[model samples]
Target: MQRNQIIRTRLGWTLLDGVERLVSALWPARFKGSVGRVLLLPAVLLIGILVIGLGYMIEYSFHELDLSTYRLKDEYSLVNYAVIADRPVYMRVLNRTLLAALIVSVTTVFLAFPYAYMLVRTRSALTRKFLLIALFLPFFIGQVVRAYGWLIILGKQGLINSLLEGLGLPTLNLIYNYPSVIFGLIQYMLPFAILLIVPAVAAISEDVELASEGLGANWISTFRYIVLPLARPGLIGAFVVVFTLTLTDFAMPEILGGGTTDFIASAIYDSFFQLSNAGLGAALSMILVMIGSVIVAAIFYLAGTGTLGVREQSR
Candidate 1:
């Protein structure tokens, strides 16, 4: 540590320090927070624009579609919300979306945890590189392409079917079902779950774990009490991400569902594009956003925001 400090002193980074001075001089001490607020203007501006768009959509959701005029009615009513409430199809689709999101989030987290643990804990550079490569290779392919790839592999007369035919055996039907849609969601979500979890696992000190073991804690006990609690933040974060993405996903379910299953996103598409019911589509979109917001709020209420790296008063 002493030697490293000496090296740091020898390389004083004079040019970078001069640039820092130049920047500091540009924003005088009297205008400190003002300059920082100016720098934040673009992001705040974009958020304001988004809030405005949401306002428009909220207005749209309350208006009725005038089919004769092929435009939204200027008069506002509770018709859209009433339709959503009275229609059982909307509830069914919403429930299916919620179920799928829940299952995909849980399954992806379960599969990702061990992978993240191994990736973070391993010391070998080559092993880490290899794992990273394997994990990211699928990302180069687009989600639609990946879903279609599953179709080709899981369809009749595909690779597995061909193998079964060669073996003079019956082939299994694989794709285009509720489970198949969930499988695709799981595949798409696994890497994201692992990426979110790695930081949490990495934050844990191996020395602390070792000390626990030294105190006569078994592997299961240590994991249940120490690792799980410490990693709850990341786990909840991954759950929220995967759940929202799956809840709003259009492509995977649309491609893999074989017309037998439909998530709420697909229903929204049908409402707007296929049926030309813009009012209903707006209502559905708002519903989707509300559902997502509620889930995130519930997660925060239960787990707090430490998973998101917010400053803790105690920490």
Candidate 2:
């Protein structure tokens, strides 16, 4: 017994020493705020680049465009904005884009939440591995390839239509519509949502969940009161990612939206590249940047305030 105790003590000390060394190796050498600023210099420069680009766009948006020469005038004018406001078509497209983004974010959160919960909470090792691979598989595939795949799947007389025809049912029109756009956006955005939720869900200790169950709480109550709160951060992260992706989606809409549809990204592309209306394009690009900024701010506020979901760590 004495020998066994000695062995255990040695093992513990060795493990602790190894952990100390690992921690020393992993931790930043210094965490002084000034030192931290040095680390952030690269990030700062990247942000500066983005800000300067967007600033130029904003400046150009306010400049008068010489119609004949397609050159910008020095004078400031709200004519670009006025043009945007006067057109009901652009307003309608903007509203639809907002709605589409909201719907995609909400759907992705709901679908990925349950999947992430299952992945982390389930005991089956194979199941966990399977889900992890599936969640990340789309990342390996190029975005254009994924969009093209969707185009094939949703195209008229494609897989779904062929299946329906084989079963003697009428071929449904799935392509070139809102449904196609939503379907493509959801697939494109799901991986991000899943990745964000998995970490938060994994952070939830099993003991807390068991304690809730032991206290006479049903599965639904346990999830509502325990699991959901702990996974709030992940949900917030996922929502922000999915929402931003949806807002900036250009490929899916272009491939599946047919000719009639017009997303803000597509409109900007048309203005800048197609029509050579750089000023209008710049204005539209600025609008996109502003929309992205508003969303990022809102997500930060919601996550910081713990309004979006339950905070698991504090509990």
User: lDDT for each of the candidates?
Assistant: 0.89, 0.84
Backbone clash total for model 1 is 0
Please give the distance, in angstroms, between residue 7's alpha carbon in candidate 2 and its true position after superposition. 31
Clashing pairs in 1: none
Candidate 1 Cα errors over 4 Å, as ranges: 1-36, 313-315
Model 2, global lDDT:
0.84
Question: Taking the tens digit of each residue's C-alpha lDDT, what string does model 2 give over 159-230?
Answer: 888888999999888878887888888988888898889888988899999999999999999999999877
RMSD (Å) per prediction: 4.9, 6.6
lDDT of 1: 0.89
Q: How many steric clashes does model 2 contain?
A: 2
